[model samples]
Target: MLSIAMSTLRERWVAFVVSLVALALGVGIIATIALVMNSALTGFPGQRAALTGTVVLLSVSAGVTGFATVFIVASTFALTVIQRTRELALFRLIGATPQQVRRMIVIEALLLAAIGCVAGVVISLVGAPVLASVLASSGLAPSWFEVSISPVPLVLVCLGGMGLTALSVSVASRRAATIRPTQSLRESAGDPPGARPGRSARTGWGVALLLISLMGMGVVAAVLPELATVPVVYLWVLLTLVAAVALLAPALVLPVLRLLTLPWARGGSAIGTLVRENTLTMARRTAATTLPILITAGMSISLLGALETIGHAQSVEAGERLRADYVLVPEGGPAISAEALDRARKIPGVRIAPLAPTTVQVTGEAGLADGFWGYATDAQRFAAMTSLPLIDGTLEDFGPGGIVVSDIWELGAGQRVTVTPDGGKPVQLTVAAVVGDSAGGGDFYLDVSDTGPRPAEAAYVQAGGEAAAALRERSGELGASLLTKAEWAATVGNSDQGTGVIGMLVTLGIAIVYSCIAIVNTMVMAATARRRDLTLLRLLGATSRQAVAALLAESVVIAAAAMVLATAASAINFAGLLAALTQVVPGATLAVPWAPVLAFAATSALLAILATTLTATAAVRTPAPLSE
Candidate 1:
């Protein structure tokens, strides 16, 4: 079996090369993520500091990459098997058992996986520093971070890659086993197996899986609301929907193509009609081409939409939470001093609200939580300059020795809590006010005087008519930059924007790369496979230009079908994400980044055109026809 598999791979190395490269790259990405996670765990202390949201992001990305790798590897290998239909049929005629044939294919996959996994590990070794640098630059990792190389993650990833590759070949192996002994005498290869047993089974599975996932989510929302905060929920739902579409893709392609080709069939040029018919006849080819597109576009749009929506929500909340006309703060410098606060307040008709910011370790009824962003401010002045939407108690009680908590806290006003400021003695304080979660900052607020002589990190000033202009001029003299409410909101938005963009790029970048490789390989092979037909068309009076145009049109039609299907799958993914976010983090609105989505679609189309056109043009440049 090993010898036979090696011989077969030697014979078909051209077709196997792309599958090998793609699998290696995909596996490399997954291994890199694992290494990064391991490094963070060993280097960073505490669960929150090490990985929380970042872990979720990396896991989702790895899941998408793994899914795509399976799809592309399986499709490419299946295509290779189809090309050897007659050869396999001859082996069957020679009395090779179906089991032997299946073993042969599986062995081939294992061997390929071994090679790919080794290559992937080597690539990951080179890529680790680059990955760490990127994470550091994006503020996702600390400056002291360095990649930790360990054999554990590499071995695990290698085994995982091998397992995925073997599983992916099941469909291809089954197809090979089912080849009849008589097929060796046929002129061309028969159709590869359908995506599933039948249309009804495929449709049934798609609906059943979708419903089951939705039901599971509904249960999570109702019974365990906190579980909705887990990113796995989003990843599972997205991959489940993607799998259903993959099952249904082959069955649905022809009908969709027919429906879309009606206008072209009626009045378009002969080349257009020919292109449409050619794509329709090749269902497996079309499915292989479209699957990667669906995954790439679906993942890209869904993730970008989710991140942008969350960022927009945060920005909006920040803007609405501010009540002061202008906020003054040093730009990454030392805190503002009492002299600066005095100078600002000396301006005519101005009332200054000073806030000393510090993080504290809280020991309360809910247990110990550290690094809570707490600010100390004068209650009366704070109340005069800003509004706190209270869930309980009033700002009038927010004086010396008093504290305010956000709605997320279990402790309310009148509860005794121990707050330990960094380098300070733990003090017992009474919570005077419990504000709504949208209060937009640290949960704990203490009296300014009790927070000691720590300089003020921020201050909000309310100025009347003439005092507003006077305040703006003396802002620099007070050693702080003055920003209007809108400007302050913009500053906050910019910070979130950096994080969001980084996340978006890392998640979507892998998918797009896979999509490009799949498109180019499928288009080149498709064109090459139909070379005889193209030559015959030219012999029958069709011009080379027309032939190329037909191929171009065919590429467009396949890309269009892929985009439509991908959009549908993405809608499902986005809906699932929105549902989870609503339960976990309330008040987040759905924000679709139309520009990025459109750009992704346009790039897919352009790649398809360029790939198909170049391949078709080269294939049709033959000097003369040869007898098959």
Candidate 2:
């Protein structure tokens, strides 16, 4: 059987080449992502350490990329195996047992996996430096950081690749095992295996997983709010939702395609009707192509949605926290001095409030890092110049013995908390008020008198007329620079936006590239599969233009099916995330980044159509008799 498999492979190597390349590239990408993620986990820069959420984002990226790779590779193997139906059927007709046939297919697949895995590992090693450079340039990693080739990740990823290939081929081999000898020779043999099992079983599993995730989240939010914010927990829910979409997509594809073609089906040109009919008939082919697009769009949109929502929320929080017309921050490294504050206040028409920002460790029950960002400012001036909406008590109640806390602290008015500052003894202070949360934990506000006169990190100034001009001019003397409210808001918002955009672009780039490859591979093989049918149509009076139209229509249907599935998946993911976030974060809101979503849809559709049309062009050119 092994020798027979080798002989079969030698004869059909051309058909197998695409599968090999797809497997290699897919595994290469997965390995590269694993390497990058490992480096990030081990070598995170110390200078900017603040639990900045970059790690979680990178981990999400790695997971999404890995999932895409596995799906693409699986689809490739299924397509490859199906293309060999005639050969498998021939073996069966020659009195080969089903067990021998299965073994033959598995041996060929294992051979391909061995070759592909080596190529993929090599590609990963060669690509590591480029990956590291991109990360460094994007400011994701420090300049001093370099890619370290870890043997453990490489070996593990290779093993994963082999395992994934084995699973894919095993499933695909079922078709070989079940097909009758005569049917294989007569049928087109393009449809993938495993289309008829308990689709209900898959659907049931999907729904069960989604329900469990939602219920689990609700229970966690109600009982243990602390664990609700863990990134891995959210990641697990996200993975479950994506898995549900994958399981549900095949069931949904046909109905959605039918609905979309209704207009053409009703009263359309002959060519359009013919095109629509062909697309509807070959639902499996359309689905095979659509699956990649679905994965790409769903993952990109969901991840981008979460990032944009968080960024927007942060921006809104920053804008609402202060009512100052202008803010001054030190240009160099030094903090704003008392003299600078006095001088700014002495300026005409200026109402200046200086703030001293620091981080502290809570020494009592409330001494948690969640609400440790502390700031000291003049009580009356702070209240007058900022829009810190109080949840209880009044900002005017803040004094030398009192402090203000954000809602994150969960402490009520008149509650006492102890804090230990850098190089200082523990101090006990009464909570004068609790305010709504802000971007940077605007928690733990203390009277400057109580904390002693510390250097000011920033000052909020309300100045108009010539006072603004005077403050701007004296900014150099005050060792600070002045920015208007809009500039200040932008300054506060831009960093998060930059990070989110970079992450989105990186994810989008990877998805688009892999999806295009999958689209091209699927369409070409599908076009090849239908060559006889298309050639027969040409023989039976169908014009070349009409044949091309049919192919384009099929492509559009596939793309449309993908778009629908992707949107459904993204919506489910976003809803779950928003619900979970609202439970943990006080003011979380649903904000869809529609532009990227639309862009993904358009690009996916365009790529699918163009790839199918290009491949079909060649089919239309082939002489009818030669097509067989």
Candidate 3:
């Protein structure tokens, strides 16, 4: 079996090379993430809060990379098995048992996986430091952070990669092993089977997963609205939908292709007819090619769209809540000075609410100390400057020793909570009011007197008549920047979402690269298998140019179908996210990432066309004897 597997790999190395590269890249990404995460956990002693964000980022990266790896590996393995149907049939004809065939397939996959894993580990040794530097520069990690290589993480990732490969190949092997010797040979001659028994199971699982995702969306919208903006939650839902679509691709791709090609088919174009017929007859291959596009384009659009929408909603909400005429920010320092605040206050008919940022350590029910960021301000002036929605109690009650908390806290009106300031003794303060969550709003608010003497971070001002111009002039003299409410909102919208968007892009980077590799791999493999069909076309008097044109057209149809299906899936995902956002930010609107999604689709389609055209053109140029 080992010798046979080695011989087969050498004979079909072109077909296997893509899988090997993809697996190696996947394993490398996973290993790198593991190393970074492990270092974050062990190296950042006594700085759990600082390292928590890094750990979360690494974990999300691992999840995204793992899913893409498994998905691409499985699809490629399945395609490989399909392409080798005739070869497998010959083995059965030569007295090879089904078990033996299955074992051979598994052995082949293990061999490929072993080499891929080793190469991946070596790549990680060079990549880990670079990745660590990136994270540190991005402020996701500490400036002193360094990658700590351990043998344990490397070994575990290699084993996990092999295990995943075996599992993926085993499923594909089962179908290959069941191929009857005579039937496979006949099918190889162009009379493919209509439908497999597994189609029903795939459809069933697809429907079940979609239903589960819908329920999850509902739970988040109705019960845990706070999670609506969480990237991981959105990712979980997006992945479920992507999987459901992938499972149902075989059943769904044909209809979409037919619909897309209907005008061309009816127009009596030969290339169109061929494209339609080919996709219909080769539904599995079309589905396999489409899966990568769906995963990449769909996931990218949905996740990025959700983030954009959330940011837009927060900005709009913040703008609507602010009753300020101008926002005063420090020009060259972190906080506004007291003299600057006095100068602004001296302006005629100007009301200023200064906010001083602070943090408090809360002792949770588990006796664990947790940090909650808040601001110190005069509640009366703050309420006058911003219309903060109150869930309970009143801002009028927020005075000396009283604390205003965001709805995230469990405390309600009149509840006493212990909070220790950064450099002060722990003290009990009454919860005066609970406000709804808003972008840029801290977790809680304290009376100016309770928070000691701290410079104001920013101030919201209400100026009427000539007071606005007077305040603006004074602000410049005080070395402060004055921004209108709209400008402030735009700045908030752009700045607050930067880290989230960067993190999301980092996570999707792996998926996008894997998807590109998978798309090209699947297309080349499909084109190689169609050499016989291309030859038959040449025998039937079709020119090489014509045959290659037909193949390219078919690739275009497949790419278009994948994009259309991805757009639909992303729309569903956006709807669920928007539904959840409505509870948190009223009148929230969708913000589709048109540029990135369209660009991704175009790139993938171009890759498919190139891969098919080049491979099929070469196949058409080769003259071969007609099969008996």
Best by TM-score: 3
Candidate 2: misplaced stretches above 4 Å?
A: 1-9, 40-55, 85-110, 166-182, 188-201, 209-240, 268-270, 328-467, 473-483, 486-494, 497-501, 573-594, 622-628
Tell me each candidate's RMSD, in Å, in order: 4.9, 5.2, 3.4
lDDT of 2 by residue, 1-628 (tens): 8888788779878777767877787778777767766666665565334223445555555566666766666666666655566767777898988888878878888888888889989998988778777766776555655677888778988898888778767755765676567755555444434454225454576578768766765765465543423333444555566666765665678788888888888887776687677656555455556777777677667766765665555556667777888888877644798877887888889987778876667744454443376788887777877766677989878877788887767789988888766556678888889975344445578877766667887888888969999889889888899988777766653343223456556755765677667667766776766667678678889888787877787778777778787777778666766665555456767777789767876777787777778878887787545322
**Runs off by more than 4 Å, candidate 3:** 1-3, 44-51, 136-148, 187-191, 197-200, 328-361, 364-380, 421-424, 437-440, 448-481, 496-499, 623-628
Against the unseen true structure, what C-alpha lDDT does each candidate score? Answer: 0.72, 0.69, 0.81
| Model 1, global lDDT | 0.72
In candidate 1, how many Å is residue 522 off? 3.6
lDDT of 3 by residue, 132-190 (tens): 99988876677888889988889999999999898778667887778677754574433
Comparing 1 with 3 on TM-score, the higher-scoring candidate is: 3
Error of 3 at 268 (Å): 2.9
> Could you give candidate 1's per-residue lDDT for residues 58-177 as a string of tens digits?
665677778777777777777767766778888999999999998998998888889999999998898777887887676666556678898898999999999999888888787788
CA displacement after TM-score superposition, residue 364 of candidate 2 (Å): 9.2
Once fitted onto the true fold, the runs of candidate 1 whose alpha carbons sit more than 4 angstroms away are 43-60, 82-86, 175-205, 216-243, 327-481, 490-494, 497-499, 539-541, 573-590, 622-628
lDDT of 3: 0.81
Model 3 CA lDDT for position 16: 91
